[model samples]
Target: MTYPHDPIPDLSADRAELFAAAAAEYDRYRPGVPPEAAELLAETLRDLPDPTLLDLGTSTGQVPKALLKALPSLDYIEGVDLSQQMLDQARAALTPVLGGCTLSLVQTSAELYKPLAPLPEEEWWTPDLITCCRAYHWMSGPDVLARTHRIAAPQASLAIMGDGSLWMHEADWTRALRDLVQQFLGAGRRAGALGDCPKPVRPFQEELADSAWSDVAEHRFPVTRSWSPESVLGYLRTTSFAGADLFAERHAAFEEEARALLDNLADGGPLLEETAFTVLLARRRAGAR
Candidate 1:
């Protein structure tokens, strides 16, 4: 999808490497539990029987980890991600959560993975539910949604959840961080090293409606996740904008400065903050329309 900001150089390979290097530090960077995400997962799976599920952009398998805890009878749960390192980490962490359930991790870009047609009379492993958590924006417009519809079974559901104003809670920090990002990008940094800017919900909502899906609905839920200063900095480091190659010479210095700023802004001994998540849910048309 075309981004409003200046186009950054494509550094997908570099970003992958950076994430791999910091994979082990993921939990430390953003340790706060995504309660809202967990709730949505549970809510979506509450009524559905044992069904095949596909999770796109399943970084560290956070969404699936929570869902498995709530629904243990899932026939199969598959996670797809572009970063091998992130997938590796997810597999390790999700093994216990996936006890007795079939779990598979495919290292691939969510936009590129094609879902095969379900076998005749087989309704269970047909991917009745598909979810994209905090990672749908990275997909390229209608193509992603269209591809999703192709793989989903009739009456299947697709949910796209993201922390809409995730970083906007702290206005001061948000503005400062944006400036820092622009400055870094202006210096001819790699494109993939740049984190994606916030996207409005209307476009994606419209895309889902135009795709092979019906009953599209958009909903917003209030949610909060707390993180310490160091953890927050670690989270920032995991972003493409803060990848190793983007700020090879200054990554350490930037982290130091960020830690200091966050430390100064802490409240009640922790850098706690509340944010909201927006979820868009749509059901696949009963028949290919």
Candidate 2:
């Protein structure tokens, strides 16, 4: 499960600081999967025997929290993330809920850690349920799918979900905000310059379809979360475009405009929008040799 390419981003030092500063806000605005993701995850896990779960790119450990809450009998849960700051936040948030369950945190790139090569073989931690929520796009397509196939135990279930419709659902406002940033920062400084846009899941779907997995399933969940204007602005602050250099000069004005936009909306109580998400659930062939 080695990565074919390095997975680290070429983020500036200042951008790294910006990410650390925004860690709390990122957790605040980061929506939990709202019943649908939790339900689907629960259903998928039900088919498996008692499982050791691995949550990849488990930012703030939110999805695992939900999963464990739904399936309290889960014996072991591990969350891996690349960001130390984010992992710290997750540890703090999950500490209270770790009662009677084994919770382990690992800070590493998902690509490099897949198949969890660094783990001791004697640890007896083979995962029967592996779930990645909202973090799959950070992975190169082939790397993630192939890695999933490798690490997962035979007949293990993998569920990958992303908040793909975040911007697409709010296209008009998002475009306006992007245009404004571009206007001030110029064309090449466009937001999401690092290809942070929601990646289509088709490639991974096709990969799984052609792979040896059986009972493959893919489905879309329509979901929504409400956000205050301030919260939404805080969420934007966590994006790559809002690095310290960009945030210092523009964040205040951006907040002002975001508040105004929220006020102008019909409800006038901030913004509520629907988002679409795709969940790919598949099981490795049982007893494949």
Candidate 3:
């Protein structure tokens, strides 16, 4: 939970390529898809003898990690992402437990990976369940969904999983944490690998609605995640903003200040916050309206 180093910032707006540079740090800090969300996908695919799962934005294989845990029977999972660096980390993470199933990692942005292509005769089945974890906002959602509609099996489903960002939380402690970061890094926020992650331009729902994958259903799982000051401090190192890359020579000073800030906020115990696990599933249907 604790890291001796802070995350190095990359500050590049190339959303497609932003994550790869911090691939190691990201794999260390990024949380996997929530259990409830994974269970939902598993339940939906329970009947299939051998399921194919395609993970969009499959950074470090978190999507497959979650899905395979829930549905170990899954036969193949292809994780597609923009960064080869990120996919490299994913390859290492998934190599050990691949067992009977195959874990294929393809490095390409979601936009270009044509999900609409016809199924190969001898190779495999269509994706029974496709999952996109935290990186949904980075994609051309309508295009992705439309293509998914074309390539997916008859009853295929898509699960988009996200909680909220620690930086974006509006709680008192979160406010205090942001204030500390701003004081140290100045008023402008960073994102991707540079600074703080930005809020999406449009709600994910709107994107889903605009596409053919409109049989939308949503589930919210209330969760209270606990963070130790040390772990929280470690997590910051992996963020796009606030990561060690932003401060350069002042990184040490910034971390020192952050530690003190966390100590004050911790008062006498660990920091506990109410967080929700959200999974938005979409399928293709005629009259979902």
Query: TM-score winner among the candidates?
Result: 3
Reference-based TM-score of each model:
0.80, 0.80, 0.86
lDDT-based ranking: 3, 1, 2
The positional error of residue 202 in candidate 3, measured at the CA in angstroms, is: 2.5
**Each candidate's root-mean-square deviation in Å?**
6.4, 4.8, 5.9
Q: Judged by lDDT relative to the true structure, which candidate is superior, 1 or 3?
A: 3
Q: Give me the runs in candidate 1 sitting further than 4 Å from their true place.
A: 1-18, 31-33, 116-124, 165-170, 177-191, 194-202, 286-288
Better model by TM-score: candidate 1 vs candidate 3:
3
Model 3 worst lDDT window (10 residues) = 1-10
lDDT for residue 271 in candidate 3, whole number 0-100: 84
lDDT by residue for model 1 over 1-289, one digit each (tens)? 1111221235256434545667767744644336555666567666767666799888888777877766777768788776777877888888877777877776666767755334488543557788888777777757777787767777678888877432445666555655565665553323344445444566777777787765777777766566677666777666655655566787777777767767776744755456666777888655656
Worst 10 residues of 2 by lDDT: 1-10
User: Candidates sorted by TM-score, descending order?
Assistant: 3, 1, 2
Candidate 2, 234-272: lDDT as tens digits: 676766554434646776776676567655652566466
Residue pairs with backbone overlap in model 3: 7-237, 9-245, 10-193, 11-193, 11-194, 190-195, 190-196, 194-240, 195-240, 195-241
